[model samples]
Target chain A: MHLSEPYLSRRALLSSVTGGTLLLTLGACISGGQEPSPTGPDPIEPVLAASVYLADRYTAAMAAVPDLADRLTPLRDAHQAHITALTRELGTVDDGILPSGRPPAVAPAGSESTPAATASSGNAAAPEVTASPVPLPAERPAILADLQGLERSGRQQAAALCLAGSRYRAALLGSIAAARASHAEVLT
Target chain B: MTTGDEQLAEALRAEHAAIFGYGAIGAKLDKATAQFALQAEEEHRERRDALLLRLSQRGGTPPAADPVYTLPVAVTDQASALQLAVTIEERVAARWRSVLPQAAGEDRTMALDALIGSAVLATQARRHAGISPATVPFPGAPA
Candidate 1:
């Protein structure tokens, strides 16, 4: 059988060859396998860093209230994904998961749960280093309030950044802003 | 019309559709849910009017709202109404997302505001519908 003689066979063969090469090229491009550029710090770093900080808050909240883990985990996971996506957009590393040294603060008496303030590590370049201040909300209500506030501020910051970004970058930032706004609603 | 004005017009169109959808949704919902729908509808109307005026000032003809919109799902009960509300917000968010690329300065800020509002409303509606997680990782991005 002369397989190449059939029009279907020829098209299929060509498509397979080109498709495989295209997939590999796209994968390489997405994975950022090339040498790093020597440009100044990425403009998106601050937003990514803020996401990392929010993720840390979730971690602290979960630690304080183990019972709320099921609810808080998903929120934390979303922020982690945000950090990953934003950092990847800048072709940077995804080391946004650093742990805080402080212990989780227990909810104060009379309150549903006690949450410590968000602690800034004071690194202007990498704001994600700001730890969660060991703020842990031991109850569902407290957790919701804490997360709602954090998400609100995060949404505002991300939206501000989106205004000045390029199209693709702005789209991503806008999505991040939208996600945070939803987070606030969900927490509420 | 400039690109930004055109994008704003697109967003305005979505708001018009949302206003129509919310009217149907509010009718089928309880007092609280219906109130949410009404507020959302009013918000869309406000934005729509503002955009229309802005387009007019720029000498761009604002696209007319569709006489009718087909809902994605039948909103027969509260659950369905909630779902429809969520869908409307998500659709509006997608439109605002498109506007961001062409917008600048205050226009960009407005688009971001609209996107954020829709996203929050979508989540709120999903929460009312008893959807798990209650939040998506990315809102207004195409799957």
Candidate 2:
């Protein structure tokens, strides 16, 4: 959808306004920060996955139009920086819940995947995982269109994520969304 | 006013400033750059009007625009004028971004759209100014 359109219709807004008022009143009655919530899946995981996907797309674009490497490399680098920032923000998700969620290949009790081994072998690095590059488009127009679509999708996802519970997460997501929108504009 | 309303009001104010700021910048630039500035100014004006209606419909009175604003940088030549345009767009983008989390549904959507619009405009301004790597890595975030 074009960015200018309102997310909800006027009728929906009216109804939501009433419901939101009640919710706000109810929310005020409860003391803030009194609940100790359990950590769920890292919300950044999906965003990180999206960043990787975007980076892979950039790589594919580079391969498809090597001459455009000068342009594509910076875009890819931005996604890489996003991955690093998001990972750092997440602060090592329970190894049990890797971003991929594929359950670290059934390692033995003393293996690297095991907490005991990880603790004993201080400074031991995790195995590096790589994403497969995307396939090439048949022509330059197709490639630009593909990248443009990917940028648009990334922008939408990041905008939705901008309302995340954590302020820092929301800020990061907003920045990514803005960056993606600029990318789309550049492509155009 | 609620936090969201206050933030939205602030965004409206920024839009008012941007709409005014473009008038100064547009005069100093070449035909092409002036065209971009005119288009961007119109967009900001449209956004401002929309935000005013939204605020009023919510029973919140929108802030009045100041007659003038002090530019972060002076606009003398075409180069400086372009820089001023970039600054205005970036400031407007930041204002819209601050409203996002506090807003919901349509308000949130409007904030996101405005933020993105300002960001793209800022990048365009930078490109027109012949800046290298025209787009910032993070448009609205504090550096």
Which tens-of-lDDT digit does each residue in B7-45 have in candidate 2? 888998888888888888988989988899889999998
Counted clashes in each candidate structure? 2, 0
Q: Which regions of candidate 1 deviate over 4 angstroms? A: A1-39, A94-143
Candidate maximizing DockQ:
1
Residue B139, candidate 2: C-alpha displacement in angstroms: 1.5
Model 2 chain B: lowest-lDDT 10 consecutive positions: B100-109
True contacts kept of each: 0.86, 0.42
lDDT of 2 by residue, A49-100 (tens): 4564566567667876789887777777677667556655655434322323
Error of 2 at B107 (Å): 1.8
Looking only at chain B, model 1 earns a TM-score of 0.95
Clashing pairs in 1: A107-A114, A116-A135
Every candidate's lDDT: 0.67, 0.66
